[model samples]
Target: ARPRVGYFYTGKTGSQLLTEKIKKLQVYQYQSMPVVVDESVSVYDAICTMFLEDVGTLFVVDKNSSLVGVLSRKDLLRASLGNSNLEAIPVNIIMTRMPNITFCHKDDLIIDVAEKIIEKQIDAVPVVKHTEHGYEVIGRLTKTNMTKVLVDIAKDEII
Candidate 1:
């Protein structure tokens, strides 16, 4: 009779192991270009940009395209519900300004970035690089991006 094969002896770890590896992957491996909106844009226009970009967050940039602020769906919703007129208000009025924004570097581990997102209760983080002027937005790491990595890992697809 053939010997029975136990699950542990199969030598193949399940999807969980693959997911663990994905979480350890570097941010530069999967980070994508951020969808940005100028700080001068009206909140109404910012909302439109969010819809047009099909993204939950937007990186607010200055004339030099440097990272200035971050705008989230909740921010827009809260501002719109307030007495202020959305059409007349610029995004900076409602955006989370720099020096307080949580940012990630391209070399950061995905898991570290994920932890920050969860801890800060933010949907996304701008991946930046130090420039002579200041931190310049290079990419963005989002919950959706991490989800995709997990899904791909589960499928055993190379990412």
Candidate 2:
């Protein structure tokens, strides 16, 4: 009898291994803490929050803390242009409202969220939990996170 060894050939390429690792990544693994703003907050306030938080997207929540909309840098920019009363304009008026916002779950595949971001031409998406009333924002998945995943995979850091 020959000595037994653990080594075996799977006939898979390096790129295939990378692809499999990426495919197995979940949103929660790379999601960041969500930056949220109340729907009633003024556009001015939302803009400030966006800048202060250093985030491109802000999840808009209602009184019950349920996600109701999304605010992006573009939205604030458009609202600021030729608008003297930014404070008077509520974010809800300028936000992408419910039934239109693209979101993901913590357990969802990161690759799926990346596809949504690309297809929608959006910078990020909220990772949420379904509630009786609506969705509750838990985290955020952004292009930066996706980039990190790629970098990690290239470095063979992801097991």
Candidate number of the best TM-score: 2
lDDT of 2 by residue, 56-155 (tens): 9999999989999999899899999969999999999999998999999999999999999999999999999988888999999999999999888778
| TM-score between candidate 2 and the true structure | 0.92
Per-candidate Cα lDDT values, in order, are: 0.87, 0.91
TM-score of each: 0.83, 0.92
Candidate 1 Cα errors over 4 Å, as ranges: 1-20
Report the C-alpha lDDT of model 1 over 1-159, residue by residue, as the tens digit.
433446355454555555566767999988988899898999999999999989999999998888899999999999989846788999998899978899999999998999899999999999999987788889999999989877777676743
Clashing residue pairs in all predictions, respectively, total: 0, 0
How close to the true structure is residue 133 of candidate 1, measured as C-alpha lDDT?
Answer: 76
